[model samples]
Each structure stands twice: as C-alpha cells, then as structure tokens.
Target: MTPAEVRARATGPTAGLAEGYAQANLIAVPADWAYDVLLFTQRNPQPCPVLDVTDAGSPRTVLAPGADLRTDLPRYRVWRDGELVEEPTDVKGHWRDDLVAFLIGCSFTFEAGLRRAGVPLRHVDQGRNVSMYVTDRQCRPAGRMRGPVVVSMRWVPTALVGTAREVTARMPAVHGAPVHVGDPSALGIADVGRPDFGDPVTPEPGDVPVFWACGVTPQAALMASGPPFAITHAPGHMFVTDVPDSAYRI
Candidate 1:
C-alpha cells in the first residue's frame, strides 16, 4: 500500500503491509525535550535506532521526502503529561511549532528478509499485529528518560532460529538480532499468549518465541518521564518510508 493510502485509513495497523519498504516509528517531542530524547536514543541504540530527525515544528523527514509526518502514518497516539489522551488518525490538530519529530528504525524492515529465508511470522500469517511486551529490564537512562525495555515477540520454527537471526542481523539499523531466543519468562514475560501491546499469536508445536528490541521502548521512557506533551505512532502502526529494505540491509 502507498503511504498516502495508509494515511487515509488512519485506523489500522501497518503490519504485513507495504512489503519491501522500510517502516519507522515516530516520536515527536517539544523542542525543549528533543536533546534528552536524542541522548536517550544514542545511549540505547538497540531499541531506538535513529533513522531521521526533522527540524523543530517541521513535519517533513529526509527519509521520506514530501511525506507529511502529521498525516502519513495510519495512526498516532497523543500524550499529555505522559498519559495517553487520544488515538487520532491524524495529528494536525495537535501539531505544534516547537515539536521535533524523530523517525526511528523499525524491525518491520527485516521481516521481508526473514520471509525470504523461509522464516514465517505467525502474526502476519494470522493477520494480527505482532506481540509486544514490556520487560523488567531497564534501559540505560539518559537525562530524564528512563523506563523498562519493550520487545516485540515472534514465534519462529526452532530449526530456523539461526537463519532468522542472521537475516535480521544484516539490518542493524532496524533492530537487528533477537534479544532472547526462547522462554518468554526469561524476559519477565508472564505469558506468551498475553502481550503488553498489540495482539497475541500462539506458538506452534515446533515454534520458539523470539524477542527483538522494539521501537516502543522510547515511548515507554517518554511515559515514565512524564513529558508535558509527546506524539508517537500507535504500537504496530509504523510510518512507511520511501527507502527500500535493501538500503538498510548490509
């Protein structure tokens, strides 16, 4: 689907759509908070890899020139003092001249590679958003940013675990490599069938739960820090960029 088409619906998740294009997570903060977020991302690259940063008050990104950040994504979450206020299809109503939007790499960029290598994503097959969980693990805090690490989980066939890792590792900018290969309990995930964000997908008999650092980690930090105002893509609804998946693949 084209980015414009995705923007029009503005209510569905972006998973299993826009194949071959790189997807990104959006985080817009007031100019005063941009530096702290920048430091937070730099200190925790695994979960918050920087893809592009727009100038304060500007909604256009270099990653997808001509696309409007305020309306290009399928959905957006508006936060006030760290609390979710609304899930809007477009954020033009909330746009501010002092907001700085950050586009972060998303693991969706590597899903095509996994599929090409014969790894199946159960969520995609089931037509559900990928499972995400907030772990007890704490990210290295930067300035006012501090929160538990968040991860997206996929059930991979046990035999293809190695191939999955190798395929994803090539795209380091999009959260390459699995953080945990099995046993969701190890990551403080109580139940694989119940996720903290997005819908859950059951694991097959030979499937092992694999976890990857998620772009949602920064959102968790933004909430914990209680920023006055912030904007982010709703979990699983990413901004599709014009860049191809191959551009980020090593």
Candidate 2:
C-alpha cells in the first residue's frame, strides 16, 4: 500500500508494506526535549538512527515531502509526563507548536532485502506483529532520556541465520545486525512466548530466535524518564517513507 493508502486506513502494522520503500519510527517531542532525544539517538545509533527531523511545530519531513506526520502512520501513542495517555489514529487534535518530529530508521526497511535473500519473516508469514521486548541491557542515556534497550524478535531457520545477518548488516541505518541469536534468557527476557509489545510469534522447529535493536527504544525511554509530552508510533506500526530501502543500504 502507498503512504496515502496507509493514511486512509490508519490502522494495522506496516511490516511488509511498500516492499522496497524505507519505513521509519516516529517520535515527536517538545522542542525543549528535542536536543536530548537527538543526543539519545546519537548515543544509541543501532536502534535509533535518525532518518529525518522536522522543524519545531511542523509535521513536514524531507523523507516524504508530501506526507503528513500527524496522520501518516497506522497508529500513534500519546504520552504525558512519561505515561501513555492515548493510542490515537490521528494526532492532529493533539499536535502542538513546540513539537519536533524525529523520523528514526525502522527494521521494516530491511525486511525486503532479507526476503529477497530468502530469509523468511515468520511474523509476516503468520500475519502477526513482530514480537518486541525490553532487555536488561540499558541504553546509554543522553540528558533527560534514559531506558533499557528494546529488541524486535524474528524466528529464522538455523541454516539461514547467516543470510539474515548478511542481508541486514548492510543496512545499518535500519538497525543493521542481530543483537542476539538463540537464548532469550541471555537478554533477561523471561518468556519467548510472551512479549512486552506486539504479538508473540511461535518459532517453528529448526528455527532460532533472533533479536534486533528496535526503534521503539525511545518509547521505553519515554516511559522511563518522564518527558512532559511526547508522540510515538505504536509498536509494530510505522511511518512508511518515499525513499527506497537501498538509499539506506551500504
């Protein structure tokens, strides 16, 4: 589907949508907090690569000049004082003049490359949102932003793990390589079947669990270090951009 189609529907996850186009994670915070968020992404590049940043009070982005950030994504999470207050399809009503929207690179941008390489995406195949979890590993803090690292899990056949790694490693802007393979307990995750966000995907026989740093790491930071107001794409949902995925591949 096109970004216009996604805006029209305003629901569901964007994984596998717009096959070769880059998709991004959205996080719009007050300008006062923008520098801190920018610094946080700089400190944690793998999970928070910045694709494009909008001017304060403006929803326009260079990544997709014609798209409106307030309504382009499938869903958004509104937060106040670090607590989630709403999950709205459109944030136009909640939009503020002091907001600075950051378009962070999303792993969905690299799935096409993986698919082309014959790496199966179990979540897409199962028709479910990718599983995400908060790891015991903490992200390096920047100013007022601080939180544990969050990771999206994919189940890959043991033999194809190398292919998955090679295909994704070239796209560092969209979270490059797998952070962990097999053993969820190593990441301090208690259950593989129960995720902190998104749906739990079942691992088929011969499949091993692979984890990648996720853009939702900012949402975890928002929950950890109470920012007065913030907006982020709901987990699994994302803002699809006009840029081709290859533009970000190295």
Candidate 3:
C-alpha cells in the first residue's frame, strides 16, 4: 500500500514488498480487559480465531516475532465508547502502556484457496472490497463483548458454489465455513447494492451469494462492548504472519 493510502487507513504500510506471506488480523485492547477479551475469543473460536496473543503492554506478536503491531497493519480503526472515532494507519500515537494485542485469523488467508479452486471473486475483479453485513444473529457473548454477528459476503457462480465451500472449509481458522448462503434477506440484508461496511459487488445472473463468519465479528462485539478504547486492522488491511498456509491445512 502507498504511504498516502496507508495514511488514509491509519494502519500503516504493508511490509516485505516482495513475497506475499501470511497475514493475520490485529485487535488491541486495554490490559485490564485483555483476559476478558481473550476468553471471549476462546469461546467464539470461529468468529475470533486467535493466531497469537501478545503479553501485557507488548505490541510484538510471538507468532510473527519481529513484526510490530503498532505500524504493521495497512490501516487501523480506533473505537471509543462503542463508536468508531478514528481510522488511522498506525496506532503508535494512540497506543497505551496498558494495551494488549491479539493476532487473529483473517479471511484474506483463504483467498488463495478460493482462487486455486477457480471460484471467481467479483470484489477483487471489480477492485472493490467484499460485502459485509450485520446480521440479526447474536454471537456467544462474553464479559462486556456481545452483539449481532457480522459477516462478509462474496458472490460466486452457481456452478462453482460447491468448489467455494469445499476450498474454504479447509481453513476454519480463517472463517472456516459459510454461516449462510444464497439469500441476503434471510440475513437481514435489505439491499445488496449497498453493504453495511465494504463496497457492494454486482451479483450477476447464475451467481449465488455466499457469506462467511468474518473476522470483523470481533469488531462488532467491541462496538457493543464500547470499551473506552480498542484497536483493529482496517477493512482489507491485515497483519502479515510468518506461518505458511500448509501449516494450517487440514
């Protein structure tokens, strides 16, 4: 990502310009509440798939050892009192000595699986972010963290629907399965043209919309919790990890 672009997202620029390695989602919360949030994650494994957790007051991820959470993400969102107030690329200025970092699995980790299976992604093709929505469904709540389940949607050709499911099902750490499929209204989505978070994609004829348990689910929970402070990787931005996809393969 360009400096100006990362600045806009406030998550910072993507490093290791050459090879595209693994990337994880970064969620930062106050140390006092880290235990609660970590338990929430453990309870909701699929939605808050934890890759690594930093020690109290540490921003460095043990899994991605040398990586720095404060400036590694291409974008970051700062939430205050349950409402988002800032979307910065880096959280250095906002970082606190009491902060705790959690590296969670990201959906981007499975894009290659979808591509290998030959399922077309309209969002990537059209240069738009995947569609995401806030569903009527509620997540397994934990202390101060509970709310509607948020999901990301991708339209796939009817013929390739099975392929999409098969490929993605292999990576549960990264939203392992489709929570819902085919109907948007069933998920409380009134209009596919305008998504709640990311850009909407054109759903062509013979394409079925598929939804995945998005990493953003935690963000939704954070919003509901309205903890005094919280941080997350911005939409489309992620934290690159050192692990290989093969390591997570089933």
Candidate 4:
C-alpha cells in the first residue's frame, strides 16, 4: 500500500504494511526546543538516525511530498510536561505553528532487507507489533534532552544471526546493526516477555533474541526531560514514506 492508502486507514500498528517502503518515526516539538532535539539525535545517531526534518509550523516533509504529518500517521502521542496526554488518530487539533517535526529512520525500514536475507521476523509473522524495551544504558545527552536508550527486539535463528546483522549493517540510516544478540538481561531487561512498549514476541526454540537501537528513544527522552509539549507517532504506528527501503541500503 502507498502512504496515502495507509493514511486513509489511519489506525493501528504499521508493521508489515507498505512492505518495501521506508517508514519513519515522527517527533514534533516546539520551535524553541528544536535545536536541543536536533543535537540530541546527532549525539546519538544509532538510535536516532534522521531521515528528514520539517520547517517550523509546516506539516509537509520531503520524504513523502503532499503528505500531511498532522494526519498521515496512523496514530499520534501527545505529551505535556513529560507526561503522555493522549493518543489520537489525528493531531490537527494539536498541531502548532511553532512545532518542528523530525522524521527518524525506523528499523521497520530495514525489515525488507532482513526478509530478503531469509531472517525470520517473528513479530511480523505473528501479526503483532515488535517488542521494545527501555534499557539501562543512557544516551549521549545533548542540551536538555536526555534519557535511557530504548531498543526493539527480534528473535533471529541462532545460525542466521550473522546474516541478520550483515543485512541490516548496510542500512545504517535505519539503525544499521543489532546492539545485543543474546541476552536481554545484559540490557537490564529483567523479563524478556514483558516490554515497555509494543507487544511481546515469543521466540522459537532455535532462535536468539536480537535487539536494535530504536527510534522510540526520543520518546524515552521526552518522558525523562519533561519537554512541556510534544507530538510523536504512537509506538509501532509509523509514518510510511514514499522512499524505497533500497534507498536506505548501502
């Protein structure tokens, strides 16, 4: 499906949808805090690779021309004083003139490469959102933006772990490689079955859990820094773009 078609549906997680296109995580903050956000992403590029940044007060992005950021995404999270205020399908009522939006490269954009490499994607196959957990590791802070790094988990077969890494490593823009390939405990995750965000995915007997730095790291920062006001794509519900996944491949 195209972005416009995805926009029409306007609800639910985006995994496995618009299969070959690049998807992005959306985070729009007031103009005053734009510099901090930009600096934060630059300091922590692995979890926050930038795809596009919009002009203040504009909902249009070059990633998918003519698509409105305010409504194109399936769901949005509105935050105030570092707390989640709402999860709305449309953010038109909350769109602000001084808001500057950042489109962060999403791991979902790299799934096609993994698929082509024959690395199984359990979450996609199970019709569930990928599991995401907030880790104990802190991100390199820039200005007032600071938080623990968050990661998305996928259970790759023990033998295909290397294949999964190589396929993803070429696409650095969308979190190029796995941060952890074996134990979730190494990241301070006490329970592999429970996630801070998204759904839990069970691994098959021969599978090894693989974790990648996630775009949701911004949301972690949002919650930690108390940004006053912000807008983000609801976890798992990303903004599908017109760019092909190959565009991000090396």
Candidate 1 wrong stretches, greater than 4 Å: 8-10
The digit string of per-residue lDDT tens for model 4 on 1-250 reads 7767987784889988988999999999999999999999999999999999999999999999969999999899999999999999999999999999999999999898889889889999998999999999999999999999999999999999999999999999999999998888999999989999999998899998999999999999999999889999999999999999999999
Give residue 249's lDDT in candidate 3 (0 to 100): 56
* Model 4: how far residue 88 lies from native, Å: 0.4
**CA-RMSD of model 1:** 1.1
* TM per prediction: 0.97, 0.98, 0.90, 0.99
lDDT of 4: 0.94
Candidate 1 residue lDDT tens string, 161-218: 9999999888889998999999888999998888999998977899999999999998
- Lowest summed-lDDT stretch of 10 residues in model 4? 1-10
lDDT of each: 0.91, 0.93, 0.76, 0.94
Best by lDDT: 4
**How does model 3 fare in lDDT?**
0.76
RMSD of each candidate relative to the true structure: 1.1, 0.9, 3.5, 0.7
Residue 160's lDDT in candidate 4: 97
TM-score for predicted model 4 compared with the true structure:
0.99
